[model samples]
Target: MKAIHIDRFVSNVTDLKPSTIPNPFSKSSQDIHIKITHAAVTHVDLLYAQGLHQNNRRHVQPPFILGTEYAGVVTHSPPSSSFPPGTRVFGGGLGAYAEQICVSEPTIRRVPSQWTNAEACAVGASGAVSYGALISVAQLKAGETVVVLGASGGLGVVAVQIAKAVGARVIAVVGGKEKAEVVRGVGADEVVDYRQEGWEARVKALGNGGEGVDVVYDGIGAVESGIRCLRYRGRLVVVGFAARGGKMENLKVNKILLKGVAVFGYRFGEDSRRDPQRTKDVWDGFMNLVEDGKIRPVIYKEDYWGLEAVSRALEDVRERKAWGRAVIRVCEVEEDTTEQKARL
Candidate 1:
């Protein structure tokens, strides 16, 4: 099977190569064999390719497939599982950029019939994290005011919609006017461009003259910008540090203490492992939201550049040039013979 492997860490995007390695699942347990239809490229994938996230213990070495989200149909599974063959599903956790993947059953979720493959692929990891963060971690309540920083990126878009669905008034912060518009379209009650002068003041002005928001979901650790916008006793959930070179160095403890606010570091993977049932519940709720049309996943672009474009996709995400989620169509799946499948 074809796959994109990071043979070495390099500053340039062209360093990645597409190679034809043996299909990964051929030697694994026959209980799972997923034909990868759509694999979404994330900023994390880019950091892994450049070896930046390696130092932070986020990624392992090269010669590894570099993706974490995907949507595809099941081509094979053990008969003991409830999911039958040819099930349309979306699963994400580890590597997903190859033509085929072998995943544990717990990692997969059945896609709603109403959702297209593109929509499912776009929602893959981001939707799950958004659900866990807004609904579970923050415990956001109806009629409360919330601020979503980095409100135009993949996870940001999902977070905005999920917050709105939970009945919160959303204040979105983006990098530019175009992104602000995107945030607004996704149901953010107000939009602010962080690049503009006095953007925090504008955010303050929106919250009834000088009052601040009840909750702040900050994906971008833009230091003082996030701290300045929060109301006293407000909860700030740190989902990621996308804006500050994927690092949070400038945050001041004094500001947090002075505000008497509660801050929580949200790592979805850890949360999922600790509370698997809760994670499954969140995924089910998200699927219901999709079925009811309360939320929609925004997919900016789809590229089937075979395996060769993986590096370019990673760079696009890292540069923030690709808006929303950028997905790569990996391979198509066909039905296996009933007799052959039964043996598994």
Candidate 2:
């Protein structure tokens, strides 16, 4: 199997590339063998490559494969498995940037029939976290207003879409006009350019009765500003610190206290690890949204082809050049001829 092999953590993405490794296969009844067709490129991948991600560094040393989420076709599975051979599946696990992966059945889910491999892979971990934050953790409801920080980025874009899917009016906070347009195209009712002064005020004005929003989905660690944009008793879900270069924010509790808002720290992967059934339930809800045509993966416009483009994909994401989720198309979709022709 060919994979983005990391022999050691390096500061530069150029040091990373694909290398041939032993193919992973189903070793037990619990395992499923998959032929990966596409995978997501994420900031966490870059962080892991640079040895900057604390949790990954603590558990996984060098000489491992890169990537966390992938969409692939099942080639082998035990008879007891729900995902039999030929099932189209997408999920998160280590070592996704490879031609093949072997994971336990519990970690994967069937890809919606309407989604292509590229689309499924593009949603991957970002979609999961976004859904978990907005629906599960924040308890966002229809008719409420929510502000999505860093709304043009991978995770933020998904958050914006999910908020809208649940009938919430979306105020997307981006850094530029182009990104504002990008989020608007994805169903955001309002767009606030964070580069502009008083952007938080602008976001607040878009809320109900020009007061404040019902929820603030914070992926950028703009703690004080996010609190400012929230209504009294609003919910704030912290998903990441992307805009601050992955640094944890020192939040002032005065605003949280004075505003009477609820602050929830959303760690989707950790929560999933702690309660697998909850993760399954989240996926079930996400799938319902997918089936209803209320949500879709927003793939970055650039096409990254094959394992050779892995380095380039990593570089693009690191430079903040991708508007949505950047994905590596590992291979052409190998659906049955009838379905392929129908899709064409």
For residue 23, give model 2's deviation from the true position in Å.
1.1
What local lDDT does model 2 show for residue 338?
A: 67
Error of 1 at 54 (Å): 6.5
Return the top candidate by lDDT. 2
For candidate 2, lDDT tens digit of each residue in 147-259?
99989988888889899888899999998777887898899998888889998988888888878999999988887899999988899998888777767778778888899
Q: What tens digits encode model 1's per-residue C-alpha lDDT throughout 146-255?
A: 88888898899999999898889999988877677777788989888878899887886676447788788888766467667877887888888787785657666899
Off by over 4 Å in 1: 26-30, 54-59, 302-304, 332-344
- Model 2 scores worst on lDDT over the 10 consecutive residues at 335-344
Those runs of model 2 whose alpha carbons end farther than 4 Å from true positions after fitting are: 333-336, 340-344
- CA lDDT, every prediction? 0.76, 0.85
Worst 10 residues of 1 by lDDT: 335-344
